[model samples]
Target: MRAILFVLLLLPALCFGQAAKQKDNPITIGTKQTFHSAILKENRTLWVYVPKSFTAGSKLRYPVMYLLDGEAFFTSMVGTVDYLSALGKMPEMIIVGIESTDRVRDLTPTHSPFWASGEPANDLKTSGGGPNFMAFLEKEVMPYIETRYQTETYRMLVGHSLGGLTALHALVNQPALFTSYVAIDPSVWWDNQLILKQAQKALPQKGSAGKSLFFATANTMNKGMDTVRVVQDNTQGNHNVRNSLLFRETLRKSKNLAWAWKFYPEDNHGSVPFPAQYDALRYFFNKYALDKDLNDSTITVDYIKNHYRAVSAMLQYPVLPAQGTVNSLGYISLGKKQYAKAYQFFKMNLENYPTVGNLHDSMGDYYVKIGDKKKAMEAFRKALSLEEVAETRKKLKELEAGR
Candidate 1:
């Protein structure tokens, strides 16, 4: 029964390796070799998604999420990451989808007869390999990713169902391994809820200020239903809902360990990953995504001008956008000795940012360049009065010298 279900569930995902050979848009699918285990000879296949902004000129490095069940989950995760990152709702980061060699053997912590009924041996069963799997990830996989890509120290670990259980195990046993955790519908029933018991015993007694964990679950079996048949019908589970809620409650009363948890009664196990992955991304970069620091006011005139020259085609230069993204096109035109273009941007910026002295001053610089000294002096004098900075003072001095 369970054995048949396991095999059936396993084949499609295993066959996904062949399908992964076909690339999806903006996502590069590939494999890597790591000597993570001797018994598992083949290393692992990893799917990677590098954002469009990850060009040669980009100076930004991104955080990472090492996801399990790559064969089934990689494509959707990549898509969500791409959409969110482009919208600036989340920081651009790499998604590393790690495929398993043999999930039944590796993803589980301890060996038992519940799932493997045919051959239950003392110590020789092809189970209890999770520790070695974790070793492969921690030692080989993580180091390889860090070395090959521009990654930051902040890392996230994400897993679904059994993978979810793996993430929780990592959290309790190796708490310092990752900065964030997104566990979707983890199997608390594994080994008679061994993980739940472990969590209860080894629970940390601290608030989650420095670290974060976002746990979620979907609607599992509804009361009197046969879970196995229901799983086959819907191809999902809701068991994690109860477990995630319980986990949240446990953490709430424990006094430490920062945590965020939600239950989606509307979502099932298979469908939960989509929304959960997106929400996890928001949670990870919530503070930085809405930051107004990078808006027009805080940027240097030179920097804006430089940016305008490069991104004007994308931003449609000189309209002086007041909201959404800052317009660097206008600023860039000013820097490139394009006096007319610079004036166009300056005037447009002035319409929205009229109180901002820099826009007027910039327009005045353009006026002086085109031999309109009166307008240039007016712009510079306004800038001087609004706020005297080194660049503005220098411009004022230049105007005085010209007179």
Candidate 2:
């Protein structure tokens, strides 16, 4: 039954691969999916990036990060996740970039025919669609992704500029929608500081939905001005920086939320997202890396188990030991002629990943080492039934011939 569940989990990857072959060797970083929205009455395009390490039929589930302004930042975000997760700085997570159809209409929370600098403009007619956009996310987009993907309950929201305003809007309005928020260069100056005022009041209240937040503002001020001077400037042209500083001050009363803020003296609005995204991910998963080496003979199974339990607690999800890590330990133990240690490692891996056919094949190798022909044949057969590995079949035939 567990093996069947494992195959079911791998089925999406296998099917995705076969369908992708219909394309003629195209270079791709993420897959574009269609999301039909009932609230918005439109079909939206969604960009999804699943880590390559996760496509191998493993049962490992990942937290999902919903990125706003995906059309601009999707590729860079994928590279950041790939680089950090490879070095064990953070866990590999699924990234879903929400591509926008009507940028200003979807991201802005209120309607005003004026710019943040308070200049009147005629192009703001389609504003105030944030409520519908939020509805589309919570009622349609999120449910679609959650139902189809192997995701944990912990979710992160990321955005910049107008998209950043929407990120804070979600936190202020629908606090439980995402577990954390990354609002880089957010336009709290929108609607004449509507969201900024609401956040100031709501963010300080007890049991506020925003449990975690990372706020960042770029150096959009005058060349000589720093964050302190910009806040006191009160010039109409200094609206964005001023609003950001005011919002940053909200953290003083927001002791209930785990939060951080930064002022990038070097990066402007166009460049701050890159550094802020990197820092925000590091902050979220600061304790994800294991302290001890799993391959060391001195470490026991109990330590590995406890380490991942701590990881699960930090992530607020049920994270299990990765099949690859445990398998490496098993193979290393086997190389040292430590059969008992090898057996323990293999058992620990198989217990965590029952649906993995590769683990069953490894177990057959261990049974053969112990000179148990009957058990070896049984393990090989079971391994073959779950996954058709050539080595498992070859060993099974040899055991039968010996009989």
Candidate 3:
């Protein structure tokens, strides 16, 4: 009898839990959205991941990251951004992973009959459609994402293999399309180093200037050979890495762009994307680690403002101080009896979030800490006017009665 009653009692709760999950909680990282591209004449799939802080009514905007090979690496990229942004190592981003339909036709710049082994192949007849694919991305995919989401002007491109080749093509020809590019183990030997020559011409002429790039090379050399020996060897299997190094030299000519490269001997072509992308993110946002600089005694309001201003300038996007972070900093200062610093932080939060009742309440706490009853009353009144809270009402009443 008790077991029957227990099951009956739990049935509603279990059903409610299931219904809630089905309604509000998504089981996957993000929704699979489709857009029909007139440029490519097909429906393209986008696996997009927005930050946890994203909400329908929120005014916060974020940079966008367009990743190639969505089906293969979307989850990993989402996890990377989530972890790094949570730690203040980088800004939260909207990751748009593009799933490939006809990769060879879309990624390769010039159609080639020869394989990577310098031998003729029959399957690559659809090669060299990358220009149209790029148009699909720029015209269709980008406009779709930007119009649907609240995004900053800053955008980043990430690709591997043939996708990486497309990224370099964009960097050389359409440099202004994205703010940063991460090309991992790029197939630079494609179409007889077509992009390599373009880069050689464009890079010296201020191509990719004022932009950020991080390209990685994997260990694609022959057996019993190191980098130097492999570069010296002109064998068919070594064309990719050799041309990659050649592109690296070309990248050095462009003093205007911020670029970094690493050769991964431990990781081969198939196994380098995860670690390479992780490192690429670090290279892209190296100066975004605020925890290293923030401490109880050393950090000031002016320094925090300057740090975000630098980030804004570097990314060419406006970023404001996070309200929660500043609030915590204010309380931290208050705990340390640094009244002036506490007041500055609280005031900054109020300025950033003027309509947030909690911020006005925090300001009331700050005024009370400094024993300024008049200002404290004003703050409590403002907080109460925004939203009625029992604690704020009590504080206002106590101040009004001169207690």
| Lowest lDDT block of 10, candidate 1 | 314-323
Q: Give the root-mean-square deviation of each candidate in angstroms.
A: 14.9, 10.6, 4.3
User: Which whole-number lDDT from 0 to 100 does residue 104 have in model 2?
Assistant: 87
Candidates ranked by lDDT:
3, 2, 1
lDDT of each: 0.68, 0.84, 0.88
Error of 3 at 152 (Å): 0.9
The candidate that wins on TM-score is: 3
Could you give candidate 2's per-residue lDDT for residues 1-403 as a string of tens digits? 9999999999999999989887658667889999678799889999999887676656667889999888788999999998998887788889999998887899988887788777787787788898888888888888898887889898999999989999998888788889999999898888888887888888788575336888988888876767778878977766678888888788777747888888888898999999999999988888787776766678667777898899888778877776677787888888788989889989998887777788888888888888888887887888888889887788889899994
> Which 10 successive residues of model 3 have the least lDDT summed?
288-297
As for model 3, its CA RMSD to the true structure in angstroms is: 4.3
Q: List the residue pairs that clash in candidate 1.
A: 206-256, 206-257, 207-256, 208-258, 219-238, 220-238, 305-331, 305-332, 308-328, 308-329
Best by lDDT: 3
Candidate 3's residue-wise lDDT over 1-403, tens digit each?
9999999999999999999888995567787998788999889899999888886677889999999999999999999989998988889999999999989899988889777676787888898898899898888899999999999999999999988988888888889999999999998878777788888888888645569999999988888777787778878777677888888899889858899989998999999999998999999899876654445578889878998898888778888877777898899999889999999999998888898888999999999999999999999989998889998899889889988
Residue pairs with clashing backbones, model 3: none
* Cα lDDT, model 2, residue 148: 78
